[model samples]
Target: MASPILPGSGLGSGLDIGAIVTALVNADKSAKQTQIDAATKTNTLKISGVGSLKSALTAFQTAMNNLGNKTNPAFAGFTATSSKTDILTATSDSTAVAGNYSVVVNKLATGSKIASASFAGGAASAIPSGTLKISQNGTDYNVDIPANATLQTTRDAINKAQGANGISANIVTDSTGASRLVISSSKTGAGSDLSVSGIAGLEIDGTQLMGSSPAAGASGAVNGVAQNAELTIDGLAVTSKSNTVTGAVSGLTLNLVTVSPGTPPTPAIVGVEANTKGLQTSVQAFVDAYNTLKNTIDTLSKATPDEDGKLTVQAAFTGDALPRSMIADIRAQLTAPGAGGPLAVLSQLGVMTDRLTGNLTFDTAAFNKTMAQPGMTGQVQQLFTGTNDTNGLLARMSKAVDPYLKPMDSKSKGLLDQRLDSLIANTKTLTNQQLALDLRVANLTKTLTAKYNAMDLLVGQMKATANNITSFFASLNAQQSAK
Candidate 1:
């Protein structure tokens, strides 16, 4: 619909043809292009809004899931403490019962450490080559030593032999600058004692490896002695190869620090008790998470008030029913009575809703009073973690919100995810249409330019013919006047 493009109009019809053509083309495409731009902006806003809503919903679901988790200690509510922390300390899990334990550590477990006789050659001392047979707790390991191997090489070979050989070797330089191969048991216990043999020139003085000796096994020298940990728990004797003791107490692991070596057995008292403060903190976390979710939903679904006392609406989902309906469903689920339980409703557990704002508010004093009641903790747990037949408030709410916030899939795409996908598809379609429109506009511009250029050429030809006729008439007039 655009007019044809023209050259400098003053040389022909004295009209601005280029400006006229641009105006006509713009008028033809303005409405359709505006619609396309507006649609793209709207779809983009909708996608962003839906993404935010999904995030908020997922956070709320996580809070609900945590509260409903039966394995969480906060729900069962227990903590452990040690009276004599210097001697021992312990931690308790949910299964730990409230009780007092008397623990007496007689001796701490020790690992065996033995050293070979001092070599005057220091670390470079060449000992007998071949394999040294080492045994720990009846398990034998062969450490291969190369010909003329030094003390350091022998140590590295012994260490390289893996598995329950139960020994690690290292070289130690004494005060006289004499290096000795010191081998120690990898584990602590009386069963981890080490014995060595098969050094062709070396003498085994009991557990000590010497370059020369009075006689083999004649010197009964004890370089290191392995011992077990002895302890008493609740008047019962318990022994362990390591200081870390388990199975002595249910759901309690005692880390023995030092031995109590006196008579009359002054036992350390370890106590396990219910942790009410931890439970309160967890409940507060749930409340905070719920409030944050509520605020996000409200902001995304409602109009805002302007400084001029007018309500200016710009929410992408302002007219969307899904967000509002989801919020309503959540609120309804929160206030409903749980199935056949003492903590039938959230109000009974001290969680109340603000009527005006529809936000949840937790009352600490009331919650404490409820928890203090006999067997109320169990009832409270039941309210949040009911069976499938009798779904708890949190469980029900999570189920309701899940369908809307879950990811897109062939079998089951969530409501918000589906909406976003549709918007994207529409936007893509609009983009294709816009591209086609651009091609049409380009073709129209070319046609109009050619048309206008032909008109300008015709006008110039007419002007040239008129000029020639006028010149011819002037020449004739001049000749006649001269005659």
Candidate 2:
């Protein structure tokens, strides 16, 4: 006998096999899927929290690093000012000493400028073009001019000649309506005087361009002269070809503005004073950065209080000990006594901490008073930037924080970075588990569907046999009654 053929779902027994299989699969998957979803959400929140903590810690570290550098402008304890800005303006770096100096501006530096003699054809006039020889500061340049070149064309050619010799040319119309070619030097000293030749009809007086007394001209004419800057500092005479004067005083740069000192002889009083305001500003910045880090730690590590006053571990990192330990270490370093100095502790320098929030605050008045004391600025600087001093606040704090922020070696990761990596790995594992469960559910669904379809086909065959038997019996009864 041949095997009976199985009908598809709902065809023979009116039973919905596909729906039954789907319901069973969903029932088996719902519980595991819920757990996976919860785990994934937790991992994602932890990654974000760790990232925020790392960012805050890094910012605080940067502020501490800036305070540790002695050469920074914030540590510069000097300010320089000029009494007569018209005569000169000056600036001083940290190297300057406090003192008053007598200054007199006798003459200002001048650059060389020379003009060609008037041309008969004016600016548009064509001239016999040849190689123009231009010299400045002992360097010479040869500029080739095409034939029938106008003053404008000759000027353009001179400028196009590329060389180290600083020389420039231009065509200018004098007050008398005559156009002349003017050549000047790029530098401002006596050695930068310019000279030009090679135009057949043009002549430039070399002596006049050198700033020496020029011979009388037949009519109105202007000549260029080169001269050096003359000045006196503290009764010492000084001469330079440029207006910017340096090296006369250690760490002082004088920018000469004019030769005439203002009325009443305003001699600039340049001196070094304690940069108390700058130091105070930097200290405040450090305090603010520390507060930011502290707040981040509190948010990440602290639990929320319920309505009934019970503590709940509702935060992402509430159960984690790393953030709490890191913050505790930082607080200990901040409160400890600093290295031996006049300002031995942060409180002495007007930096204090809040009892509740564990954040730092700055007292401007106290800092100003401490900085005003003699020799206290150097001591304050040493407290933060001291060399490997265990008691130094910033030094100790940096040492403690460095391990967490920086990696130990090429193969090792930072504390937070490592935590995030672990969370990511766990997330991948959860995903793989979910995929495995789904595959098992799919296979079970296939098997169950086939069995249900076979059962329905067998039931349909039994019903057909019963109907045929009943029909034969009815036919027999009807024939018997007729007899």
Candidate 3:
């Protein structure tokens, strides 16, 4: 709230003009300064809330990352070559030797064509030969019939229609000179259904022609044209579709080069360990953020106050007690001893406490040493991962922050991420308000100084005038006495 000054409050003090103006200007300045101060305080609280939340999140992420590395055995003693891909070969011998080995196939070229297909069995009796319609994947194609259109011509038409569906079709003549039409699906799926329709003389796989009808054709004939490659990973049979097989896992790719029956193929491994490193880094980032937030809250809450009982007007915070309350709630959640929690209590984790500050002080040397223990990670994981206990520290922290972290949770904003967003927004608003108020105060101060200066000048003039009159009267009195 700003103070509003009226004209008559000892404003000019007899030399009314300058003095009154100065008083008015000073009052306005003070009011503006007050508003600016209030706005700044509000902003500070908003920033504090956001900063604290971010720090907590970072910490949680860091803890999770550390635990992940510690718990995942695959990451232990894992190393990668320069290319980050491992190409290991396995050769079979007449004498079978049993050892740990996984097959990897590196060369498989896959192309599916209508395998040994014929239209109405290439017989004139079945097709009757006018115009035939072939439909694939629910799209219709028209084929023109000439006076003497051969089965090859119809096959060629089907091949030409391949471009419509982004599928390639071609006619291949076998060694016996038997011509076959292959209608390949552009993509594989049950949805890639093919059918024959609107044909006066055409049959596909002994099915009569109808108008764009899927059911009119033989079952499994229209959609049955597909190829599959089978490979094994870690002795487990895995079947996959695409030629380039990087889609299998985060850091694995399987390229099928050959199909040799009864022989296990060589496998290629790529960049799996590198991916783990990325995850580790991500987790550490979270920890770093968490620590930052924790530090910020601790600093603000514990800062000593001004001796005046009232914070300085320029101080940027409000409710001297709110930060402490929030910190306590957060700390309680973090320090709660438990199994299946974010952390297994501060003390159990080797984090010491300072009695006077009531803060958890980390002994980096001791924590590092303890973490070196063989089962340290396992112990940490047990606390955080299982649902065996509902008192998990992560869960508890989540619960505590939930109120402030959701979007649309509160009319102001919810917690999960919304609280931070709201805080930032509030901070901006506070900054603008404070800046405006500061500018107004500056203007008011200048106006007041000018007015006061003018008033002082006028006062000096009045005193000089009074002195001159007194001297003139004294001179006249002396002259009269002489006469």
- lDDT per residue as tens, model 2, 117-155: 667567887878788887767777888988879988888
Ranking by TM-score: 1, 2, 3
Give the runs in model 2 whose Cα sits over 4 Å from its true position.
1-9, 12-16, 68-71, 75-268, 303-314, 336-338, 365-378, 387-396, 466-483
- Top candidate when judged by TM-score against the true structure: 1
What C-alpha lDDT, on a 0 to 100 scale, does residue 170 get in candidate 1?
80
Candidate 1: minimum summed lDDT over ten consecutive residues — where?
A: 212-221
Candidate 2 displacement at residue 290 in angstroms: 0.7
How do the predictions measure up, each by TM-score?
A: 0.58, 0.56, 0.42
Which pairs in model 1 have colliding backbones?
A: none
C-alpha lDDT of all candidate models, in order: 0.74, 0.72, 0.48
Q: Which candidate model has the greater lDDT, 1 or 3?
A: 1
Runs off by more than 4 Å, candidate 3: 1-17, 20-101, 105-264, 267-289, 304-405, 409-412, 415-483
TM-score of 2: 0.56
Give candidate 2's error at residue 463 in angstroms. 3.8
Better of 2 and 3 by TM-score: 2
> What does candidate 3 score on TM?
0.42
Best by lDDT: 1
